[model samples]
Target: MSQSSQFSLLSQRRFAPFFWTQFLGAFNDNLFKTALMVALTYDALSWTSLDPGLLNNLIPGLFILPYVVFSATAGQIADKVEKGRLARFVKLLEVAIMLVAGIGWMTHTLWLLIAAVVGMGVHSTLFGPVKYAYLPQHLKPEELVGGNGVVEMGTFVGILLGEVAGALLVSYRPVGIELVAGASLTMALIGLAASWRIPASPAPAPDLRINYNFVAESMRNLRFSAQNRTVFLSMLGNSWFWFYGALVLSQFPVYAKDYLHGDHSVFVLLLTVFSLGIGVGSLLCEKLSGRKVEIGLVPFGSIGLSLFGIDLYFASQAYTNTALVDAFALLATPGAARILVDLVLIGVFGGLFIVPLFALIQTRCDPQHVSRTIAGMNILNALFMVAAAGVAILLLGQGFSIPDMFLVTALLNAVVAVYIFSLVPEFLMRFLAWLLIHTIHRVATVDVERIPDAGPAVLVCNHVSYVDAIVIGAASPRPIRFVMDHRIFKMPLLGWIFRTAKAIPIAPAREDPFMMERAFIDIAQALHEGDLVCIFPEGKLTSTGDMNEFRGGIAKIVERSKVPVIPMALRGLWGSVFTRDPGNLFERSFSRGLRSKLALAVGMPVAPQEATPEYLYEQVRALRGEWK
Candidate 1:
């Protein structure tokens, strides 16, 4: 769970070379794009007669055009071909394209340069599926989040460095153009060199026949991706992030110039701030998630994005001055620092928002279709970015200010978050679990690995308090279905949370015989389907913070569908507010308040035949002995 362990992947041949290969690709793309953008926007050259506005917009469209047109075919190619070999080929193509781009830069040949842009777009489209799909093939499930964080951090860092390098190199008079060309070519070659060191990854589906008809193939890939509910929704969330990023970034130049009244250096400063924030945030994800695929960060990230975005709108509503300022002067300005902070926070929150979703998609999707699924995600991302541009144009045409646009996008983000969370309540449930552990207690879990990583299992624990299930669920790496008293499941606000978590509600036969029977049936089916079912053998929370006699309901469960039973103990929460103390549950819930310490100890799994109610009770009691 340490940061070094997460970062040690850098020293391994399995990850490092692929990391640089991707890094160089991203660097080259931004390098060329920035050079072209500066050339078009600032009248750095008189090579073309087209309107600057038209060219400025046309460039982004041309670059992303391939993602829409060729991503499906690219996905199939990734699946059918060996990845290491394909990556080298892609890098070689980048070198060739850069060579052509260099010639265009030297001669100021607009068409040639534009062709290079389109070529890079295709290169990216081909590599897109390979980038994400490569990780799961090489890294373990627990290492995925950290690995992805490193990759994302490297990508954004490359982008930032490329943009800065391009802008600086372009500013140096006549030799500037040649330097841009040289840099692109040099980076491409370096990328090719790095790609050579990547270890081999055989084709996942060598028999998948090529289908050149991109339109129909794209639809098919989309359909394939949609078949998995969580993966597809994750794709939608990823696309929405792109949409939000595109809208915010597309306005930076104008916002910097007209609103902040800053010069080019100031614009670079803004980019640097946001870029560094993302790099830091992305790297921080590994530690925040404790080296797991923790989606709780998603909701946390969304909330920060909305809050900061809205604040940014208000922060930039009135600039301190209308006169242009250099980077230093801009920082020195009274209110300018707030704008910069907001930008940085927005980027930080964005990094937090995106990394988990990417990891989730890679790990959750079918192994065979990973590349194609990524291709589908790329296609959707392209469409969302394009739609983002269109929406920006439409709103700007209506004479809205950039700040107003930010506000609108912020509001739209809130709406999108709510919609997605509703569709997959696990996100919200995880958030709640994460919140409970983070705010209410510092939960230390031991031997949580005893819980099966996959397949059917029965988790037997001594129920200590009302919040015991949430704590256990949060600490567990895999999802759990808890069997709780129907009354607690029907509690006011807590009821909805339990239902969303898919917790089974059980009752005594005397209270509701039909419900009790239905609960047992659900438990058997869940176990039959290879899900993890957690049941408190005592069948109720401890009223006196002591052990209760084991119930026969657990025996009924094992009789119906036997599975490995993991014995666990809750070693804290004796007097916490959620416990049934001297007063009502509500009155005692926050008695220990914030930062209360707790521990959950999971014992070795007992075989189904040996896992009687009494045995599990004794195991849990032993585990909890001293603390209890």
Candidate 2:
């Protein structure tokens, strides 16, 4: 695989057919919905006599209602049914619904079209579990992030095109409605065609006896999801994003017309920029995350989401334009570009926030129950989106402006983010480690895959700097439990990171025998539970840029745990700020260039019987070479 391997997956049969199948599904869904929304918002009297605000919130609510009512059942169906067949069946349902919608469009019957909306919602509800659960089965663990990013990019791009198609097709003279109807039906047929090409995906739970009770199954699904604390909170975080998004996105039509003084075309422009931004951010996840499911991007994304969301409010306040204008004319206005940038950035950050969470959920959830877990999340998403609508109605009724809603959502995002991070400090810890490598040092790993993916193994690395654990942890695909000197846990900020990572803090035998004994027990337990534990055999940071004599402690660990030892080396990290730099703290901070070139080289795993201290020392030294 090349650096751009994510794009290359599109050429293979395993991923491409599914990609286009869902892409067209999204396109057709949005094509129908956006056309109806634009027509209703722009020319409401012709479509219905109802207030536009009620209709705006009501439409989305109707669409999301099925997720709450049917998602559990849908998840059960996805798990029990073969995926390719299910996908094709769902597409056929889409074709039938679009035909009904086409009829409603020609007749101008709002109720029929609204029913079609509910039907499409059912279609999506059925497909939701299949859409996500399918990826983990088809792609390698490393590919999940890139696969998800590509899918997300395709979904958003489809949405962008669909919204554009809806707006332009429905705004044309004489037969705009007919054009929308024809185009939606045609896309539905094309999506159905695409679905037929998808390869068979075996059901994970063919024997699962599905319950028909929505309330009961919904509870069961949530119970299964909540069984894992991190997965559960992640589900909530995922749902909260929808809440934030619904509040922000649902306001755009009105935000465009009433606040920005722009026409329906301007609404299209806003949606366009936002979707395009999400596409760019989604694609960037693979590159930014080093092609792994780095949840650190979650915090990074949350920060950007809140910042841009608040700025959007200010940007809207700064705009003084009062005359109605088209998209082109609005762009030429003084303050419009700022608003555009804010929307795009919000979308970009939104992509960063969401893709990793999805990947994490997939990787972390129970394999057999992936569909139900996703279904549970979908239910939560629906609930949050509904709550967003309620919040919008309540706030708007209380005289809050759309921009006020944006500000409130952004602030709430920060509060929720802090709460979630506090509950799971690993997200924050990983963020710090990821930040260190990406910012302080450029990290390259050689043969790093030799570190076991799924078994307990002892990783022995040279201790050259104070932040060696952080660098190694960030580089490993799976989590590592580090055994380090207990005193390092007393440092101010770094202490928090290590403690949050659940690093086993140890003391020298001569200093604190009790703590030393307890440390070995903890290491034994971690290994028995099948976790990767790394110990710096040098036992302390190097003072003279040379390896300390091999310590007996590693031999003791191997004897106790009886796991293979993987010797690793860190190169070019001796005189950095985090090391024993000769300069004072202030001077050491920047005297040498702060950023260092670092490489983590992993050798083949040594058998437990042969991983003696003296042998591993030579192995690590040979790997480190003269880079220091």
Candidate 3:
């Protein structure tokens, strides 16, 4: 019920417990892992005869392997049981694993500790599906973006804090070891308490038979994911982000040590900057997207990712320091701030790229299969991360510098983004609409919520510019299928965008009678399928920046579909670049500088019987208030 912001959800019963429970789980995992890393690095010869390098490499693999093996089965389990109870069960499992880990710590038993590591991995694999799917069930659709941002922020903060705790606490000798054990157990218990407080979330698929066969069930989930093309690709985008993240984050210590000539303090600074960037970027999504699942941010984020990623390489090259420095000394070095800013921007873009994809996955997928779909994505994420490791290894083996690796990853991001956007132009189309509104105009909407949130609706708006449909599309929270003039739909750069958007192209009866007929059929079908269809009832852009005679197509549309007719108007777009300003577009481009201010007003819906083109025209004109 709270639409004001996602921060309000933290005070409510449904989300607060889950947020803390998840945060504690992340914290405990990192704490244990960091403790093990410290033990291996500082005291490996004392604890065991094994090589530290081997353990360093093996531990990450150990943690990720369970995701590959058990995520499918985990998804099925999430769907078959109540989430609150399962979360509590998982938390208890954590306590048991930490107890074993505490013993391993006290006894200095490497094998037992390694087993504990795998157990923690299994615990995480089980929780992955529920972690994502749980939010959609409890939060309102509009609240999803903010909810995910907070979750991501919490996860990163926990990782940072846990790492610091493990490293610092383990450095104080025997007391430090004892502290590590105590902290892990205490955090596990706290997490269990938090989970116990989570409200019951009923299973979406209660009657579905449980499938114990991991491989078969995994395939079934993958199949379910494939049924929706957009959701599946969004999952792939999500996984690719993990690949990019793992590769870049894993390299920070080495980059700090070898390239920047900095000590542990510098490494921590780099990691901290990156994590904070992601947190800031994640939080910005709710504001930038207007509290909707806006895929446009995906492309924007990717662009920033690639751009800053390349800049990082150059920034690293600018670092002239050769002697090892502490965090403060590193800050004193020339270009250090630039390198740090690059990391932060990369993180910010990474957050932008990822948060929307997760929200889109949750909001777009089938409710019953959301967990399974997320599980499938987890499996792929694990695979991509493994592949990323291989890529890093191969590149490093070839004697490439860490900065060069950063460059390669940034270029790869751009290539992959272009390919994916080409395959599904919706991402690119939305980006164009989003970009136009963001760059070319400052859009303010009044009573846009008057448009129906669900079911079919005929949106009749006055046409003011060639880009009116795109402006309206960007302003509306929901997607709009615009019926456009066939000629404009066939012209140059804008044509490609129109086609990608799947816009319905229409023509006058004298020019193309069949096209007009098909356009009407498409409108009827779109309305029947509960889509929002927007038509310029004036049938053409006003050549004189005034309303044209209202056409009859809207009458035929409402007569056939009989949906609610919402009257809307775009004000203050006349005489702009996309308008017939002094004859033809492109004559006065950027005359108003970047970000021209504009407003859209939405009037109440008229009954279908009263939804004549003339009536809608007058309503739109009333809202417009002589802006033209």
Off by over 4 Å in 1: 1-4, 44-54, 583-593
Each candidate structure's TM-score, on Cα atoms with residue i matched to residue i, is: 0.96, 0.98, 0.94
Rank by TM-score (best first): 2, 1, 3
**Candidate 3: worst 10 consecutive residues by lDDT?**
51-60
Best by lDDT: 2
- Give the alpha carbon lDDT tens digit for every residue of 1-628 in model 3: 5559777888988999999999999999988887787667657788878655445546766777788889998888899899999999999999999999999989988888999999999999889999999999998877899999999888888887777787678867659889999999999999999998899999998887878788888888888898889898998899999888877876765677678887656766887889889888998898888888889899999999999999999998888889889889988899999999999999899889999999989988888898888899989888888787778777877988889989999999999999888888988888888898887789888998887767899898888888888888887777788899998866898888888888999999989999999999999999999899999888778878788878899889888988899998899898887776675445556566778888999999899999887787889889999877
Give the Cα-based TM-score of candidate 1 against the true structure: 0.96
lDDT of each: 0.87, 0.91, 0.86
**Candidate 3 lDDT for residue 233:** 90
Per-residue lDDT tens digits for candidate 2, residues 125-195, read 99999999999999998899999999999999998999889988999978899899999999998998988
